[model samples]
Target: MSKALEPAGPSDGVNRWGLVDLFAGCGGASAGFLATGAFDHLWAADNDRWAAATYEKNLGHEVATVDLLEVAESSADVWAAGIRARHRGPICLVGGPPCQGFSSHVKVRGDSRGRNTLYGAFVTLAIALEPEVVVIENVPDLFATRNWELFADARSRLSDAGYRVRARILNFAEFGVPQERFRAVVIASRADHPEVRFPAPTHAQGAFSSVQEWIGELSPVASGEVAEDDAMHQASRHSKATLEIIRQVPADGGNRPIGVGPECLDRTRTSHGGYTDVYGRLAWQTTAPTITARCRTPSCGRFIHPEQHRGLTAREAALLQTFPSNWHFVGPFDDRFKQIGNAVPPLAARRIAEAVLSGGSHSEAGVVEIGDEPIGSSFSVLIPGIRRRGGRLAEGN
Candidate 1:
C-alpha cells in the first residue's frame, strides 16, 4: 500500500518485505508466507507458551508470549517506532484472532463474548504500524447476524484508518487443504496500493486432494499403538465399548451403525438431536471434514481413520490440515491436537501469500453475506447468493 518502496525482486539479493504475525498459532500462516521467499519474519506473538515454543522450534523465530491486549493498551507510538526501527521495509500484518466466540459449534453466541472483540487489538496494532496490508482470518460465522455488527465495526475502523477493506468466506478445500474448512478472511490494503484480492480456487470438486493422499502413508497404528519412528503418530487408547462401536462402523466413510453409539444418537429416541457425523469414518478418496481441536477422539465429528479402528493420530490430523510431515508439534496429546486443528492450512496461506506478491486485481466476488438463521443451529444456512457446488461454496458475482 505504501508506494514509496516496493518489495525487492529476487535479483536484488535483498528481502522484499517484513511480516509480523499476531495470534500466530504454531506459525502456520507464517510458514506459508515464508514459503514464497518474499517476506522476512520480523516478529510473532501468541499467548500460549507451548504454541510459542512450537513456533520458535519450527520457524527459528522467538515468539513474544505476552497477550495482545496488553500490547494494544501500551503506547501505540512507542510500539510502532520500535517495530519500524527493526524493519524499514514495507510490512504486512497477518493474524487470525481467537474465533471460538464466532464458531458455529460453540453453544453460546452473542456480543457479550469477550473474545469476540479481540480483533480490535489486531486493528489497533495495524493502525499503529500503518502496515501496507493487513489480513485478518476467522470463522465464517463472523458474518452471521449475531456478529455482523462487530464485523462491520472492524471494516469501518480500518477504512477510517485509510485502508481499502474487503472480505470473503473462503473454503480451505478450494485452496488444496485436504480438509473442508471455511474461514472468513478480511484484507485491508492502504489506499495507495491496489486492493488485495482473494486467491482463486486452486483445486475443484472431484479433484480435491483426498484424506488418503495426505495420511495413508503413515504406518497403520491400532487403537493405543504408537509408531516407533514417529512419536506423534501415537493413537489414543479407546475404551472397550468405544472400540466395539468403532469396530461396528464399516470402512471408508461409514456412519456409526444404528444403536452403536450413545442413546442420544438413537434416531428412535424422542430427544435425538445429535450430530450424525459423530463417530463417523472419513472417506479415503474425499476431502476430510473440518478438523477440530477434538479430532483425536472418535466421538468428535468424522475423525475415525478410514479403515482403522481408531481416531486420527496427531500427525495424521496435521497432515489433513496440510502441515508438512516434518513439522513437529510440542505439547501434550490434546494440546498438540488443539495446535494442529487451530492452524490455518499452510497451503491455503501460501496461495494467499502468492496473491499478495502478485498485487492482486479487484474482484466483485469478494464478499458473500450469510443467511439469517439461528446462530446456534447445527447446520450452516447460506443465502442464495452463495451456493454449495462440489462441497465448496461458489461466490456470487
Candidate 2:
C-alpha cells in the first residue's frame, strides 16, 4: 500500500497522499490539500484541544493534542514507520507555525526568542524524519522580520540533509484566492530534480475589481452581524464618526470613497493615518481585504460583510478562505474564525501542493536541501535528537 499513493485528480480518481499536518488549525490547510483530493491526510497536531477536535471531526484526520515539539520527539520514528508501512515514500508535511512574534499585532521582545524557537521545532522534525518533501507556509510579515532567522537556518539544514529548498513570498490574491492575502511558502524536495515555482494568479486586477470582488454576493451584514452560530463573526460597530464616514462611502466606494479630511482625520493619525483597511466597505466587484483572525470585525479590516450592515459571519470568512460550501468547520464559532483566518486557503494550497508534488522534472529521487546558515541559531546536528511519530529516536553518530 505504501508508495502506491495516488494524487487525487480534480475529480476523476481519489487523491491519496500520506500526510501529517503539524500546527494543523481547524484543518484549513488540510482542507486545501484535500480540496483537490490530492492526498489522504494521516495525522494532525495542535496543542489546543478545541483545534485538534475540530480538525479531527471535520477532516477525518487522526488528531493529536500536544505541543509540536513534544509529539514529534516522542513518536517520530513510529510515525515514520507507520507512514512507511501504510503509504508510499516518506510522508509529506505541511503547516505554518504561529506568526504572533512576527506580526505587527503583537510586541516583539528579546530577539524573538519565543517566535524563533517555534520555527526551530519545525526544522527539528524535518531533520529527523528526513521526509521526502516539506511545505512551510507563513504570513508576509514572517519574511519582514530579521529577528527570527529560522528560515535561513532551516534552508541550510535542509540543504545539508540532502534536500533542495525553495523559499519565496507569494501573494495569495494572485493565485486565484478571492481575498488579497500575501504569504511566504517554502517547498523543499528530497528529489534529484527539485522544482520550486509559485502558482500563477488567475485573477486580473481592475480598478473596479480589486479585493472586494468575491465578498459582494454575501447578504449585507453590519459591524454587529454576529449570528447565534459564531460570536467572532459579530462585527464591532464603529464609532459615530467612523459610521458617519462609512455612510458616505458609496456602495462601490472603498476607503477612497471617504477621504481623511480634517473631521474624518485624527490629529494623532497624521503618521499612520486612518485605520489601515478596517471599517471600509468592499467594492461590489473586487476581492475583500486580506482576511485576518479579526476578520469578523468591520473595524478590523475592510470586513463589512458585503450587503449586510455588519461584518462577515464565520461561514462567510470560511468562504473567503476558499472552503467549499459543503465542507464543515468543527469548533466554537470564534475558534472557527481563528482557524479560517489562520488557514492557507484551500485553493491556494491545492495549487501549490500540485506544483510541489508534481513539479519534478525527473522521476528519479529528489532531495530538498538548504544552502547556508541562518542569521541566528544552530544548523549542525547532534546525536539523539527528537523524533516525528512518537517515542525517542536515536541520533546519527
Candidate 1 lDDT by residue in tens digits, 231-262: 98989999999999999998999988777879
- State the lDDT of candidate 2 residue by residue for 206-296, as single tens digits: 4322434444444444655554554434455556765665565545435524344333444334555645455666655666667888876
lDDT of each: 0.78, 0.59
State how far residue 233 of model 2 sits from its true place (Å): 7.9
Q: TM-score for all predictions?
A: 0.87, 0.74
- The residue ranges of model 2 lying beyond 4 angstroms of the native Cα positions read 1-16, 72-75, 99-116, 193-196, 207-213, 220-248, 256-265, 268-276, 360-397
Model 1 TM-score, all chains together = 0.87
Clashes of 2: 61
lDDT leader: 1
